[model samples]
Target: MPERIRFLRERAAMQERARLLDGLVERERSRLESLAQGNASAAMPLLDLYSDSALSEAAGLPLPSILGAPADSRAVDDRWAAARFCMSLLRGRKDLYARFPYALSEAADKNTFLAWLQSDEGARSTGLTPASQMHVVGLFSGDFAARARQAFLADARIRQVLPHGLTPAGQHGLFGWFMQHVWSETETHLRREEVLWLFMQAAENPRMELARAYEFTPDWQRRFPDALTVFGWPEFASWFVRHYGADPRWVDVAVAPEWHEPALQLRIGYGARGAWSTKYPLALSDVGQARALIGWLGSPEGDAGLSATARQWCQALDLPAVASELLKPGVNIIGHFCYPSGLRVSVESIAEALGQAGVDTSLRDLRTDAKDDPHHVDFGGPEVHDITVIHTQPDPFFPESYARSDLAERTPRTYRIAYWYWEFDSIPDAWVDCAKQVDEVWTATEFIARGLRERLPIPVRTLFPGVRLTPFEVRKRSDFGLDEDRYTFLFTFHMMSVMERKNPLGLIRAFRDAFRKDDKVSLVLKTSFGDRHPAELQKLRDAAADSNITVIDQVFSPDEVLSLMNACDAYVSLHRSEGLGLTMAEAMLMGKPVIATNFSGNVDFMDDGNSLLVPYELVKLGKPIPPYDADLEWAAPSVEHAAQLMRRVYDDQAWAREIGARAKASAEANLSLEAAGRRIRARLEEIEALRRQGR
Candidate 1:
């Protein structure tokens, strides 16, 4: 089957499963409603069908009315029925179990229920066997005075049933029950011999899974620090290694002589930890395990089991050596390198700048399904490097991207940095939380840096990305279906970048206000991704109707896009927000007079001396446009001010040419390749200095 068809089928199956789960929750709610209003006999049968685990999820029904039902009459059968109802509710209701003593006190037949609770016949009916008697007693004694509860735990019958070992099924058994219920009441209740026996059983149980044993190990270490010595080191080591040899925590027993032989065997069996392995080595993350591995590799036994290359890698696990490796000048720029998006442009520019500065750099593509682009150019270098700069946004960031790339094997030693961009005044809390995973953050503009520095505790610095467009052969206006005699103004955008923020409609309004359909001037709106957002595209088309405005919604190669900009007389963008306006910068580099909003990241390079700047009012985003919260603020550029500027640029051709020259000089001074390269190199050198100081 084709990939698209398979994806659609999988999506349909997921929707069907969601509907089925919704139906089950609805049926459970209806049944619960019936039980709440009905009598005891009617509720009993419905109670049997209740799914404690599944029905108690986020969509769970509330506690049934039977829980608050009036106390039963003195009739023997009615009292028994009431007791059974309470027991049934206790199955999964921890809330009710904690307050069961109060419920029993309110019952007129408390004595009768207490007698039945300890009877074998009652145990058979409720499934509360002798093994769980302690749990029942603890619940019933919740209302007792402190002294009385202590006396109940000290009873001889309770002492006889105190669990000393694991059950045949490998469960913690009655000992776990005692600890949960009465351990707080009196720690001295269990004899020392019984405590020792329980620990011994837990440590040596062959049937216990590694996860279950972890539960006991911590408590054992806390209460008895020398547990390995008491249990006989050789015997305990054998058992622990059998279950937990692969676990990095095995270093806890590394001091013991018995641990050496098994440790060597286990390391040899696992072989070298390197990039070729599918599993990430847990040992490298643990300080004790990493140190021990280094020591073992230098030993005679370890020498025979490993190759020379593996031995050298293992020995380099020293902290100082790792830190030195991280300070190297090489970098791995990770992102969607092949995709034709703003992020890809930023990555390419940064890589080129680094290369020009004589810094070693490599490009690692994270996206496997990038759209086919005939204009894509490969940026090649080494597969691994000392530093990794991730150019993805925080909201969709996943460490799995690193794992899937060639950089994963070197991740533990690499200094990770996230190069993020945001347009809003405030970032989402969830995105901020994800950003914390990186060592530091670098943003393209101070607008983004300020927002990040306020929320992020780590280093947040501004580094402008370089902009260098390749020389393209200019095409005539007639070739692109534009009138040769008309003065053309161009604006390009992607539909995926929210339409509200881009405000192309506001631009259309400004253009129509500036010129008429019969005027010798034209506005060409270049855009893409219209197929996914047909509604927004239709709105744009409807607004541009019967005007000198032409909308071209199609994908274009990088060279073609640059040629289109060259064919036009000017560039414009009345955007509400921008992380960093790349297109406007590109146009300015080509000596085109640019008119954009006097706000956001574009302001970093644009000014009154170089470009036409439109005034805007800061307004609250009344409704949320996904990825941006409703409370955040963005610019609302004035259409009247923009229209006046548009007319001025068209009427005075000589002044426009002078402004275009200034724009080009400003771009070359601030957004040039050498400028960006200097900033990156200085920041990296500062980081290396900090590492040397151990700050």
Candidate 2:
């Protein structure tokens, strides 16, 4: 529907004109050959044979009024004229093709050429003769990436969201970027799926509920930050997937057309095999840890199918050996683990459980001085065997004094274990100390893995940070309306959070420069402070206002952000770095492409074929910093190159959309919910194995 798409479509028609010429020339040669051989034939030879009196006569019509052409000069003249006409059309076709690049279905284009031949007298007059091959020397031809882009873009949803190619009509430059990124991503994506499973305690009634609606969404940069964050929880995830995709439920309990308009197909995943919901009130990561422990306990027969390592973890948890049965006939664990603000329950429950189970308990006895109360669950515990803890942060939670002093002051010297200790700023020392006593280490990303492997004598597998995506509710373009059809830029800038790695100051400056260079542009910053920049925010606002920029800020649900992105034309991150930049993937899932810096796990999903790569350039703390922030400072890598890229999107709507579409394809391919979950599940297995060893 966009102008650029229309152009590509029309250009394709023009390109096919030349192919028609090829057919004309071939026909000429056939006619000439027939005449040279002397043949004259036409349906009902009697008409040409004797005219009412020829009743049973024959014309030398090649000894055969059997055929229609004179194996004579008539055929020769027909061939010559056919050749000339073919040559003329061929010349024009070549010229147009050489000048532009666009899409054309070879089969369809051929059919149309056949129709044109019937109308052109010059071509049809060569009757009974085949077309000849024309050797027009200087013809032009260009290749368009049809099959490749089609594999990604020619989907029903894609056709619906961006009916025509937007990349061709707008800024040619932006269009190119979109094509390249989307192509690479599509080449990789073989399936698109969003699996939602409802897991609760078996006692509460465990059943798998499936969602039934979906939408072709936009890229992260095109969506608001609040819209992005709301997806971090599970309830939101279940709701979004249910509404945006097919309802897997037998009967819909909650149906809201305003929210469930079918926009995308829902594909199922491995979630088909259920897991117990664990019915706990916490992060899945913590649940994973619990499952690992449960796996440690051997079978009640004292030797179920679990591995030796899993058996050990079971022992650590003081869980009874597995039931004589290897699999719990009708049991599934989906949501039984929940620990917020740290693990719940007191040490006494731990000690009593272990003590009753006949496990060793002589080192810890905080129960004596337990002031948190006996039944309160936080009371002291008896001696413990080994504690296998995981680090979710990049830095150590305590000094050696805090990490070891407490345990040393009053506990046994067993295998007090630690995994992925890089969080310790001084890991070299932590490694040597831990290695001297503990077992195993873990890393979250490739960057961290490489760094840890270099320093420690152990191996590290790149584990993913625990993340569960929440889905977006569907809504109207006007719900969070921006007055114009202008491309809307989105950023989830944490008001002033030290933990985040987004580059605020750099973003402000770049946004101002890019938008100021053009008037028909808008930048919406999703922050807690609504356009009220605390002095710092003001400077950026002042710069943007001076440049005649449209700035937006507001509080809305994730669905609203989805609405805005669907209504907008493009997305821009232009940040320097990101671990995985979940937002980046989310943007693509929404069908909007993104412009992200070339760094970190963002690479795991963002590629040139699907995303715009911007140069991130910024300085902090006297040296070049990375994209992730942990300590006192963090800088999302920088790109000094965004000015040009941003301007192109702002000026060219078609170009921006092509890029967004490409990005959407990438997310759907590689980072789809199903794909990400599998990766998470695999890592969960590894951690389970590791913790069991220490147990």
Candidate 3:
């Protein structure tokens, strides 16, 4: 009977201890919530209570309650205790401000910060760099914590990784440390989603084996493209190495080519599905590898060595072993390659020319899919190369296609070149900075290069756009189900390019004034990207409501578009300005007389001897389009004059045919693939000569 009584007493004592621990945990959790809600008055007390000894003493429990808990403990006692400690250390506004210093400065910044907190991908947009926003559950009170916990538990990846389950201490310990380290490593492009994904993969398996991760065609690669970049984070890598040991897959690292060694250089980037592929700098999977190469290239010895290595690699890879950097160096031209638009046509033409010039040219698509030209329609995958040629708008923010957001700051050590243009007399302020950064500024025309050079310190080169007239399958008016009896006037414009620049409305006005309703003249307004500007397209439709205007809104394949140009009686462009007037050149190459404003870039190739150049007067812009200053003047072709020219082309078929024949001849002499190839070769030689002379 005495033994039984003693056992009951001990049982009661144990129950009391358990209750004490639960109560302490509850109190700490409450304190954390208070702090999270901006109760600064309770912060110091909460901090004191969260100390190791204080927490242990208050709970009447040992450190092992949390430190040695199972992976999947859903219980709140020690979980709350550990969560409280983490919260105390990193819960308040101060903690957030510390990570993102500008978060609370301006109203916009504050809104952005709060918006991030409320976002579905909070970790991606907020102070929780490497940390998952799931940790925020510990920072709030009542139902909020429960909801967060439930959501976290629901994640498939998390569930897969945590078979044993998540303990509060484990969450706080590893995650907290990782996040802190990530916060310190500023200037990283690592998204919070990517970190969480990496952590889950690392934690679930714990084996840390990474061999299959880098495989050229790993099964998991299609699902997890960002897997490799995670290893670039030193904190995660260090922790992973310590816990899981070095990955066996990394055995190839020892054999990986040195920075200056003769090995194939694969230029890769991220894709639409967030998978890293051989696209552009944006999809770059191996940040650490690139950085290592960058460091080496920054040194003179490394630079010389890499230059020699690039040539050797080119030879081994069966790429064009071009002249050295002094002339035309082997270049990786990164842009929208397979896109079937006029701009893409120009880009492809340049790539072909570069190839013909004996320069190793790899055309990388920007991972953009177009019905006319899907991703990698021309060339893709890993290859040997040197230098990076970004062919897009200079400003990273200005709807730039090839300007990879990450490359804006993480400038490569190679001879970076930006092939860009602006419509105005003075380049945009943003473009000036971009130009200032690049080794060379390649403009499509002397007009643009001269304008930019006046303001920029960088050397500007006139790299005239190449025109390649490949024989396309002949398509007729019936192919588009158009009126076979009517004479068709074709005009093409991309909506993404500002409407005011393309001046489609002006063209519509000229066409309306030129021909009568009874006249057998139909206008084909070839428009693309109508979805982006529904209202503008509507306006165009409204303008053409009473006329014989056939609007082909859908993007057509290059062969079809070229055929459409061929079927047209004449091509007309009342464009205010063009970078190179690629479409005008294409029309000329197709044996079609081009009626274009005799100003800006068109003047580079258009002339009265071969084509009709509509006289234009310089007109001031009403409002400033960013990059296009209001003070600058663009050609405003007289609508009356355009109408007169159209009448002459219609009434005098023999004269038009004569002009068309000359246009084809002019295109052959000035804008042919061979001519462009020669130009590229000459320019490359000049660059090589300059480099050899150490100029």
Candidate 3: where are CA atoms >4 Å away? 1-329, 338-340, 367-386, 397-412, 692-695
Q: What is the lDDT of candidate 1?
A: 0.61
Task: Summarize candidate 3's per-residue lDDT along 11-127 as a digit string, tens digits.
Answer: 997687557445534554554456556554533221122255644442234644322332221222332332432333332345554554333222433445434554656544333
Name the lDDT of candidate 3: 0.56
Q: Write the per-residue lDDT of candidate 2 for residues 482-519, one digit (tens) a residue.
A: 54655567665434322124554565567666654446
What C-alpha lDDT values do all the predictions have?
A: 0.61, 0.36, 0.56
The candidate with the higher lDDT, 1 or 3, is 1
Q: What is the descending TM-score order? A: 3, 1, 2
lDDT of 1 at 59: 19
For model 1, how does the per-residue alpha-carbon lDDT over 111-165 read when each residue is reduced to its tens digit? Answer: 4455565678666655554535444454444332222222222232332222112
> Which scores greater on TM-score, model 1 or model 3?
3
Regions of candidate 2 where Cα sits further than 4 Å from its true position: 1-391, 394-444, 456-459, 465-469, 476-478, 496-501, 516-518, 529-568, 616-620, 623-640, 683-695
